[model samples]
Target: MSAVLDIGSHKVVCLIGQQDSNMGVRIIGSGFGVSAGLKGGVVVDMDAAEVGIRTAVEKAERQAGMAIQSVSVNVSTRSLRSQQMEVHTEFASGEVADRDLTRVIESSLSELAQPEDAILHAIPLNFSVDGEDGIRDPRGMFGSKLGVDMHFVLAGIGPLRNLAHCVERCHLRIKSAHVSPYAAGLSVLTDDEKDLGVTVIDLGGGITTSAIFRDNRMVHVDAIPLGGQSITNDVARGLSTPMEAAERIKTIYGSALHGADDDYVNIPCPPMGAQDTLHHHPKSLLTSIVRSRTEEIFELLRDRMTDAGLDVYAGRRIVLTGGGAHLTGVREIAEQVFNKRVRIGRPNGVLGLPETIDGPDFAVATGILKAQFMDIDEAISGPPDLSGRRYRQRRYSGGPVGRSLQWLRDNF
Candidate 1:
């Protein structure tokens, strides 16, 4: 089993998992730690984030009775950036061999300039052999030259360095890193949504990450820095409650669809040891605060969708996942805005995962395990197949963060 860790703004989750021949993953153990030095899914204080990671990893190791040195992590701050690049290469030799083709593809990718942007990810989108598009792999195909399209996600340099440094300090080998929103997509997206078209909105505590998927490819990825955490902050200020109490109220009674009664809601506004409670009606509180912020977030998402010009069907769908998705009436709010069938998706297919960890919250971690299994199968799909590990070497240069399939894997 491979040990995977998800360093989230809310918590650090670790899991020991692996897949069988059936392409199904079985999680043997899991651990979590309170996040110390992170905000909105980005590491703001390096030392604190390292402490959180160490605590979580050590707990997972103890639970599994084994040591783990390497792990896959998720990145999901609004600071992340992505772009689609197409590179072309010419074959010096006429023969079609695997190494020759990989070199050409890798070299074509090497020309891709990584500016001030640190690499969030470098994923092979699709290959075009001699101008043919949509070729997943072209090992034996005859082509004098090859052209390829790759999707790369980059993060703001300063925030990214903080993350890398924090993980390094924890003594975890970064096998690969995945954008958090994209990682969420891997666990919850349905096949039909990917085949036709859909959007995934991971309503994280600090950021609302969005990705568009069509033709089984991730056409776009982006995020808004504001998320559920903002709402809680607003509640805390408006209701004059502690941040902890605001979070409690938001989780227990938050709703997106404001009603006339919302203005009449008398939230038990508790202050620092005061006998008289501040009586604020729910509607008055929501309209000026909660609804406004949620609408703003939805409008921002709408703007992003419009900018992408995605190929969507009439019943185009949206998958809502993450802690914010639990807010009442969230699906309805998203449906009206996107004009699509919206539903909450949960990660449902693991074998040994505990019930406590079985929910939309686990989507990114579940996707991480599933994605690794997919890469392994794809790597060994070529000819000269052997049942045992003796015949083939496990390729290390693989990661599971992209492709449109991520749209479903992410959100609830």
Candidate 2:
């Protein structure tokens, strides 16, 4: 059994489930609550965030008829980013051994500057032996020089500690932490899309995240602090409406592409104060505001993708996920700006979710559950020593030595 807690800027989702046959997870219980004490995916009020977390978890527990002691959470706050590190070593007079693989993977950690930021995911993209690339497993292969290309997802230590503390306050343990965009990609991306290369753009409330994947591994990840919330704020300020009414209008009448008769549709805008009366505005005006802001976001995304050196690797394909993806006509706008084929990403291969929460909004939580069953470290917890402690976590999965060491620890 496992639990997944997806803490976002707009909502907190908790899911309880168990691993079933064929490496699939069946969701038994799910709960979600309006997010509080968060701004742009970072917790601003620890107490408020803790309360929300406890409420969601308790709801799921009640539904599952079981208590959850720990959970896997998603991390997207504080500039979540990915970097590439390459390591090469020469073998002396023999075939490559498990120790050689371990050494090369360990050497890649040197790319990290310090302990203030931790690697959320260390994915071994590929291995090369004797200058021949694309070796899935390098063990027992004779090669004088072995090389590795490692992709790492990193997050700031302070934000990570704060997130961990919030979860602990609910009397729950964090089984593991995963990068948000990576988790979303895990749930929604198809095998063909991953193999051919694709980018996932998570249209979240407080942050818009982009992740590039190729050969079934995440190669790049970047985030822009602005997201759906920014658009809502723009609506509120532009129409002189309250936050609630602005959000309502954005959902009910907003569109990224204007229609021929949008001006004929007038949406009722509730008065700002109790004494004020109702006001109405042309729906076209509302959509125009949304379109302008969304365009800016898409343009910024284009710039970021190119700046990351991932423009070519992404291969002109994109998958949109998260709450903001629900906006009508967003796919068209994104396609125009990115010049790529764009489609909405929904969580697949999961069972037993209420129709209400089974959309792209919950992709991260669903992905976390999927991660647990698949043994994807991006889904499972890594070393548990990320709390600004002196203890360090080691990586061994890239080679046989690490696997043997882990097996001994488990069996001993």
Candidate 3:
């Protein structure tokens, strides 16, 4: 059994499920709550965050008829960066073994041991044997030398510890803190898009993340502390309305691109205060406000990609996921800004999901569940592992927080 908990800036979702006989995840229970105490995906108030988490998980527990002791959560904190590590090593017997691959993978962590950083994921991007390149799995292959490219997802230690503290306060152990954008990519991207090269942009309530996937593995990840909530705020300030009214206006009229009929349409607006009378604005103005903010987001995404030396020059394909992806014209605007093929991505490869909750907004939660099933499949493929404690040591690096993180990983 597995529980996926997604704590975002605007919502907290808990999904409880298990793998069926056919190896597909069956979601038996789900819970959602209005998020509190989070800003830009960072926990700003532990007590408030814990309350929301507890409420969401409790709802899922009631539906599943089971109590969850721990959960796999998504890590969407700001300042999340990726560091690349490439290493070359020669096998003593000229044959690459599982142990040799493990050695090379571990060697890539030397640069990730900074005190202020916590490693969220250490992903092997590519492997090569001898002088040949692009070997997917090199184990059991005879080779004089092996090389590996690894990408490490690292976050500020302060934010991670705060997250851990918030989750702990809920009386639930942390299973694994997965990078939210990576999880979103896993849920929404097709195998072909991954192989041919595609960029996944996750637009959440408080953050927007971009991930580049090539050769079926993630190559880079970047995040901005801006998202759908920013658009809502923009609308509120532009229209001089309350946040609730602004949210309604944005959802009713928001668009990333302006349309021909927008100007002719008129919508009633609430009074700014008791002293002010009601008014009306052209729907075009509302769309324009949304357009400016959303355009800025895509432009920033393009600049970030350019700074990272990544471009759609290769395949020119982009997939948009997360809550903000649902906005009208977002895909079309992204296409114009990046000059690439763009589509909205929703969660797939899972079963028993209700239509109401089955969308890009739930991609991260679904991906967390899929990730757990993948781990189970890997463990079942080989001999049985020893015990949870031993597995933890193999999974997490040894450091001041190693033991604590080992406890966290063991709960998964």
Instruction: Give the best candidate by TM-score.
Output: 2
* Residue 410 CA displacement from its true place in model 2, Å: 22
RMSD per prediction, one decimal?
9.5, 4.7, 6.4
lDDT-based ranking: 2, 3, 1
Arrange candidates by TM-score, descending: 2, 3, 1
Candidate 2 lDDT, 1-412, residue by residue in tens: 9999999998999999897787478999998877887887899999889878988998999999999898999987846878887778765646777777776776676545457777787888889997899887888888678898888887888788888888988898888887788889999999899989999888899998888989888889888898999999999988889999899899988899999998898888888889999998888888899999999988998998888777988986899999999999999999999999999999998888689877888889998888888855231145334653322344323368776675454334
Please report the TM-score between candidate 3 and the true structure: 0.88
* Model 2 Cα shift for residue 370 (angstroms): 0.1
Error of 3 at 120 (Å): 1.2
Q: What digit string (tens of lDDT, one per residue) describes model 1 on residues 156-262?
A: 66666677678889877766666666667778887777768787788888888877766666657888888888998898888778889888777766777767777
Which 10 successive residues of model 1 have the least lDDT summed? 377-386
Q: Which candidate is the best by lDDT?
A: 2
What's the TM-score of every candidate structure?
Answer: 0.83, 0.91, 0.88
Better of 2 and 3 by TM-score: 2
TM-score: model 1 vs. ground truth:
0.83
lDDT (Cα, tens digit) per residue for candidate 3, span 306-335: 877888533679989899998999999999
**lDDT score, candidate 1:** 0.70
Off by over 4 Å in 3: 375-412
